[model samples]
Target chain A: MSSTPTALPDPMTLREVYQQQQPYTRMTPLLVSESLSKLIHGDVLVKAESLQKTGAFKFRGAIYRLLLLTPEQKQQGVTAYSSGNFARGLAAAGKILNVKVTLVMPADAPENKIASAKKLGANVVLCQQMEPSREEAAQKLSEDIANQNGSILLHPFDDPEIIKGQSAVGVELMQQLQQQQINCQSLLCPVGGGSLVAGCSLLFDPFHTSTQVFGVEPEGYAGMNQSLLVNHLSRAPGKNLSHCDALLARSPGKANFEVVRQTSVKGLRVSEHFVVEAVQIAFEELKLVLEPSGAIALGALMQYPAQFRGQTVVAIATGGNVDKALFTELVNK
Target chain B: MSSTPTALPDPMTLREVYQQQQPYTRMTPLLVSESLSKLIHGDVLVKAESLQKTGAFKFRGAIYRLLLLTPEQKQQGVTAYSSGNFARGLAAAGKILNVKVTLVMPADAPENKIASAKKLGANVVLCQQMEPSREEAAQKLSEDIANQNGSILLHPFDDPEIIKGQSAVGVELMQQLQQQQINCQSLLCPVGGGSLVAGCSLLFDPFHTSTQVFGVEPEGYAGMNQSLLVNHLSRAPGKNLSHCDALLARSPGKANFEVVRQTSVKGLRVSEHFVVEAVQIAFEELKLVLEPSGAIALGALMQYPAQFRGQTVVAIATGGNVDKALFTELVNK
Candidate 1:
């Protein structure tokens, strides 16, 4: 391993990125609930990315990444692998920017997601997740497409550009908190591929030094937490076993984990049952539709209230791209 | 009844109400969807007032009405006879402004809504709706409270201030349409007491005559449509009821119905099945959690595509305050 650190992207530059990109992206409200504040024994502000375009914060990074592409890159088009929120975000961004997007999903990825991607004008390629040679199959598909069509892979979290783009979220949060005159003592966000958390860490690092950042993970896929402890990205807990497949990243990004380790942040693992309960609360009380992964922050708040009391906390409700059928199942149950 | 026409409130002065009340009231997104456009066979824009504070467009009127109250009036407190969204909105706005709110809900009203009002610091007064005498009971309660506490009666839809306040939605739609550069041919909204439709009509009448303003009503409670045709708010359809209890008004506001009748726009009477299906679609596709009334515009579009095709149309998603248990029941069914 190299002893020297890679040049970390400048937080100021990310702020600039936010300024430039805000017209295209939404400045989602950071609303504090007097009722919720009293419930948790703290002032709680919700950074409602639930209202973000494509119903998640992924659109922010996806828009920035697509916007920054060169004329040649734009012509060559972009590729991303996900059957989830990011894929939808990329597809929507691609459609708006008039760029072509090719998304690769496991064959069993929710039909709704596939339909949504297609609706947004993406060429969807589906491969079975259960096949013995699936991982190899996906890799070969990516390489063969890249070779033939000169496409660029828009990795969900690992790319430096994507991380820098995601950092815009933190920049917005800091500015919004200040504008609202809210003194946030802590920030909580669900950790999936660490793109959103990494961006937040970078943005929160330069200001509010005492503000602790926390990432929440569904129990079966605490890769980011494990990786931060070991000082490297590590494998996901099990082979495609987590119900929160969005959070089932095989490893955290090296740069992302490094930022998390350096940012005075901690990770909390929430049980799947708690995630479902949080989702129910959000749907029933908050009148917000949150996917299981999207509800992880709420799960942490619900499951562990003592750790967060008296602190002005902000929770990043990452996305609302649950399969509608899954929501019916959860809510109905 | 007064023989003279009810004077329309001035829109210019209404701008001040919007400025004062909009901070607490959400200017919920006016989203244009391609999928809904395809389904409706025209461009479809949704003014998602369902996402408003207190989960409905009712907040706009309630907050504005509260702002207009004199210091003496505020000190005396306010009261309303509502078993639905208005109760929650009034309670929430009152909590923010330190005004006392007394809500009279039917004992049979959804438990969740009653709980929400209580949780938001409202004085909850319940009356039984099971008997024919319940209306007289409500009137007596209102009179008793008014005499005892000097409380102002906050009628849900009939008040001039309330109607004018809700007109801000029309103003917002106009502004957003300009910003989005969309020339809508028609506006569709759900009609319960006719306040939302009246407000919208005020905008479309002299301001944007080219744009027709339509209202959707549940077949179970199409009193506004009936009132428009008969030239009087009536209760003939009161026997035909709705599980969408928020929309079960027996009569339209006389003043508001007068305006709704003058519009060139038509009404669409849709079934409960379409409303349920539309709510499902809103949750599933648009990532919006709308109450049954909120989903009716979409329902109308889904049921009567031929009437809306080839024109730019905007739908008012009236509210998003469905009870969780009821939501579960509806989604499950």
Candidate 2:
């Protein structure tokens, strides 16, 4: 899947992506919070990707995906579907590379995210879909837009190169751990299309055998968790009004599911109720601003600390694009 | 003043402090926010010390101060007085070093900061001083406590060791800018007792003449500005009620003013109204949680961008120990 006319796919370790990303990426800090440690009764190393370029880990994948495009593909530009973080990440990446990019976001997506993407110079189209989920509707519109405009189709989290690009986070995390001389017992990442978790799982795979990776999802939209349980791409009932707008995918991406299925992905489902508290904890204790979806992995740890007791765990705080009004309300409450 | 520091503080470059802090410090990212750049039509690099240990750059100084303590001093313990960030930093540092730390804080200081310091296992004394200023009263109490306990009295900011330690922020910034091949035109830091700005000025001295260091203060408490203008430690009229509790020092430290005076520190005074907006900017655009004092340096840039127009400016976001209630009010309104 990593094979390109110019580069081989499988041998293309995240190390190469890491090298390519050096020019654009901020080495997000791995921080240990005393308050968080006290809460969980163990050490919790927070990988603050909330401070990543475009304010999310999605940018790592977005930039890498754009970088790997064939010259012919770059000439035509790229189109993708994202609710928020990916949209902003791709828009920023496209602007950086001087590539024409189009994004399909749900009409109901956070206004701040939509506005930020437009400001970043992306052609943004809002898809009006609510039957299964806005994400599916956005996906359909993005596919049509790509076909009509003759642009290369970019899956927000499905394609192998994108997953490979996303895996750069895991690679960087591993290197940081090694440098600190600390061995992690488990790594928690919030999963949407399962790309981040699947990619992380690959890096901490059986060969590394040192740390277990767990994907976290909101209870209703636990697509990756459901899929893993069923050993197939399963659809989740995405009917709940979750503040985690970024993780509203009704089903895991096909390619993402394939990778997770092979990798034996373990996932824990978290309810929406704990999200605001998690966000609050980030702002108050961790001095980080995280969107609801971005705070889910921390939410997982906070809601179920006993499971990780006595083990050093790292929770990936993935994004920080919450709208001012909503963020005000969430944190205030 | 740089002598013996009990330990040769003049030779105690920030590089050495940086090395000492490797075990506890997070190399806070120097982020270029594209959104922030477009807002002011200038390049602004954010040194996110909001993510530093104890959620502030004060931790850098606190830890370094604690680390350099003589064995006798360590055995006797230490005492310092701070309204907020320094209290937390010193408390956390003391916890790590197994020293009994005592902190004297204003009775009216932010509840969150008080709670956090207590949580870090410090002996907290709330000073009942609303006249002259909470700071002076706290200092008087701290002196009494030191005498009574026979512990080493630590100056929160005036001590050369603490100032030398805080200079590590400047050193890190220079390294980050060098790595990105960025030649910063001006570096901005929020000033209280002036330790941070004083330390920063030493490194970006006549040697690295390209970058000018500017210390920012809230309008009513621009003591460093007044002090620099007079070539001595001058007290400002501290009458305003502002949210920047962490930066409420009515006068810059005598030693700190001496260093900044020699270094020719440039100063900018920002109104309290603009500080809330800067806090909002950090929350929304930068994905960082910054206390009013921490965001004041960025506030200076935002309130007066014309001065930094068409040039690259690096603003130090010093801390993020803001109360949720205050944060909600600042961001919401």
Candidate 3:
């Protein structure tokens, strides 16, 4: 169900959002991975958003969304639903901006994520219903809460303003690449509901540069890839279990899909094994902790090396919020 | 034994070395740890040298050492002995500079460290002797190799030039602190033969600023602390075992001790349990993978929070090159 194509934000708008968020956001290092480069026979630079505030890129969007709120809306507070990363990010942003945040998170969300959100002073409601899906159940509860309180309801990745805020990753990457004199041939982003890829693709599109943008997803949850192929909204099979808990969304958001469609963003799906291997590699070689969801894009590059051989590529590591037990099991295994 | 006080390098000299090494080294992020800050009722900033080339701050010293070599010396190559981090860093630096590096590492050194040194194209010779100590045995072997081959022998931490090279961390940190406008009252550095602490103390000393510097060591291997207390070079008891394999040196280097003494740096010791807990805390809160040696500074902060209460402090995370099994056990435990 596609509406009229939404216009991409102008370059000026992207810069304005980035400048506003600069003070709060960390300029995460763009680290060159010599080991990964040798494996692919090309340059592989990882933008470590895993080191970002709240341990994820989701903080950028969350903070920007709160900044866009009216003075009255700020006073009224906001509500949102997240599996983990977004919940913690929003809670942290709310703490920084002195706004109250209410989060509805799945009961099975990683314990650390839940604890961190509550630690940041967010009122968290545990959603136990997994009938349709955990995400949908939590989303419904958050909406109900917002309706009752008359506070703003923010989507994790579907809103245009959130997309604009996430585009700051691209803005920062471009500046870093320029400083390093790197001519990037491909840019890879881990996609769940596709906000990160959609926003990054818009900035690194044909109109702006010749960089081929890719949205990488786990094999079973490849809705973004499927939707891009058909040029329409689609659902993932969701038939297989995966360790990438943060990236199990069944479908891409309509707003995100529309943006990726217009920007000609490509998609790739990686196996669970490769995602775990990527996480381990990040630990051993790059000395960075990456959640499985965050390492997925790097896994895609490893899974399909021929496509990027002899070219400079950038992979956006989305988050680092996995539980200790899961991370230990994956890395040790 | 104590030697004449070593003159500290002038700021201009430190700047020159930093400028020369900046292109090859990563300007790792200076992350403000909100959790740590809240715990101590003060701000705590972590300089993540764990993200440095070769996954440790040793790479900064290694590269700088190689750069300072004369053409003839570079052609003849160099030899050194280390337990792990220094070996890996020197090997990687040799690969970059096209110099032949021969390393003598303890046979019991971490498997990943030995493998990485070999992978980086160094001629690695494992020393099985642990009579006096693993480090001493390896050092003797390295010296013999250098004598036979007519190659220059390098002291991993005792050399004045190498300490100067490691001072780049201080130069970079000072600039970052200024940018963030943080008036750091205390600086903590992990000590292995005291090179890092000595280098940093020279920069943050009373002659330059009022910052109090501390060298953090494992309780059993607190050689730097013992040496500083008696105002003479002394040896650690070496009676207790520790997981901080990279920081088991029984004594601070004479050159390093002299520098620290001249700078009036203090020392702190953390127990093995606290070191292990610090590793887990770094993983969970900072989203950084730190080897026990690298995490010792953070451990010092946690162990003696009262010492730094209500003060802006900086802790240097020195490395992240532990084997997967060890890291898993530590983080999971």
Candidate 4:
């Protein structure tokens, strides 16, 4: 696939993708954080994608992906598997475009996410937990369903199309920052399959020479961090306790890892405790509600403030779709 | 004063205020709520000023007020009184403009409010709860401080300039709505001293012809509501066991009420129960953390859904500065 691969797309193509998706998406605010600026002694901007359609940034990629489908393919529909965020995003996108979408999700996915996907008219198949990660199990089941229904199978994050769609975040952020005359020194993004970070790093530092862009992941599931350290795709010990259900991907996507290496994306690992604290801080200071995975990039700041002090930074809040009880418990804690 | 009353300003003045305040404040997002749209069967845009600087719409007025002070007045500084939101807004505004500020507050004001004022280098005088009302007592002390210090005594929400400054919210909202091609049929703004609603009503329906803009107040502190019912200023029973600390004004401001009467602004009163529910829903559905007073306008919808079921509505989430403990309890409940 690498030998015959197409050349990486240019920035204009990415910007066009963002512009096309504008009608189907909300241009989430680029909010300046006063409390964070005081803490860092520099400007801190939050790209609040938590307020995006379906309450996550995944909708950008999902909608863009569906828009690119051929007329026949759209009529035939598509199949995919996701933990939660991607499922809701894809479901909503499919519903909007009048395309049938079948999703295979883990049985233990959040109730609200599952309910939201079903409400958006997605046919959901709940896969039981299995070896090689619940995601892999769901993926295998999704492939089988796609074959049975003679439908196109779409990868949630590994596909180049998905990565290109995710580039909308970088394009939008750069547009907003330029309008405000803010030159960001560092950017932090929560990494699951690494698509968002990879897409953004390509835009912010295509040559991988400067502009520190860090991908934050939970401690035990820091596959992107581990992979970057050895300069190769590597798996992490994903069998640890974590509240960030959306960020438990054991390994980065193959295409995503390739882009990260090319763009020199840095990685950070945060503990659940810091993630919980970040959620509370987001609610209190930022006035935004972020799920644990969504707050991990913020946790990276709290975990190592000295490293970023006096540097202009931007953090991407990825999703906000936790169950009310879980959200309350995290807030109380 | 009414013998030759100062003429009310025009929309050009309001747009200029927003332009001048652009650098000092955030262009808060005008977000369409998908969940809310589904519930109401029409569009529901949330003009979230909760993410505004110093955590409320009061900052727009406070900063514009300070910017408008005469050179001598700016050097001498200013004195004002507030329950919580205005004090923080004015203090922060003064600090930014290098003007000394003195604030008179009720002794029982929120701890965070007092700390925020002091942190911004404001001299705070805590007035004891005496006869009349806590706000009235604070107002009297503020006047004395202004006279002793030879400082300008600024009303929190009474002056015409202050009203014009607060008009930024309406101007900004209209710009956003027009960009989206959305015709706002109904607008809901939480009312304390009535600046926000008055400014917005004037912009949307100056001749009292169309566009129903409602001033929402707490159940017992419905001073703006009571005042608009008659054609004259009237007081409300502000004594209530509620947690909306930022909205305890016993009566609408003199100038604010006059503007409301001219604009033919309508009003609504919400119970504390729905306010709490709105806060929780904000966390759950909208991915925003709104203070109870900020969430009261959303509560107006929950209180009487029938009145606004099929209309395009916009609710103003005014501030996001409630105590963490109180927020947690409210979210948990």
DockQ leader: 3
Tens-digit per-residue lDDT, A252-328, candidate 4: 99899888887778889999889999898887778888999998888888888888899899999999998888887
* lDDT by residue (tens digit), candidate 2, A1-333: 321222223424778877897787778889886666777788999999988988899999999889888889999999998999999999999999889999999898899899999999999998887656787778888999999999999999988888888888988998999898889988998998988887887777655567888989998999888988877678898878899998988788777777766665688999877888889888887889999999998889878888988788899999999888888888878
Candidate that beats the other on lDDT, 1 or 2, i.e. the better one: 2
Ranking by TM-score: 3, 4, 2, 1
Worst 10 residues of 2 chain A by lDDT: A2-11
Pairs that clash in candidate 2: A2-A9, A3-A9, B4-B7
The runs of at least 3 residues in candidate 2 whose Cα sits more than 4 Å from the true structure, single-residue gaps closed, are A1-12, B1-12, B39-42
Fraction of native contacts, model 3 = 0.90
Sorted on DockQ, best first, the list reads 3, 2, 4, 1
Query: What residue runs in model 3 are displaced by over 4 Å at the alpha carbon?
Result: A1-3, B1-3
lDDT of 1 by residue, A197-266 (tens): 8888877763546677888888867888887777666665445344565676656766677677666568
Which parts of model 1 are misplaced by more than 4 Å? A1-3, A15-27, A33-35, A70-77, A96-100, A119-121, A129-141, A144-150, A207-211, A239-242, A261-264, B67-77, B130-151, B171-183, B208-210, B258-266
Question: lDDT per residue, candidate 2, B114-164, as tens digits?
Answer: 999999999999999767788888999999999999999999998888888
Give one digit per residue, the lDDT tens place, for model 3 in B1-333: 537654678868988999999888999999888878987999999999999999999998999999989999999999999999999999989999999999999999999999999999999999999979888889999999999999889999998888888999999999999988789999999998888888898789977797999999998889999988998988998878898999999999988998999998998999999899889988998899999999988888888899899999999999999999999999988
Given the true complex, what DockQ would model 4 score? 0.70
Return the interface RMSD of the candidates, in order shown, one decimal each. 2.6, 1.1, 0.7, 1.4
The 0-to-1 C-alpha lDDT of every candidate, in the order given, reads 0.77, 0.86, 0.91, 0.88
What global local distance difference test value does model 1 have? Answer: 0.77
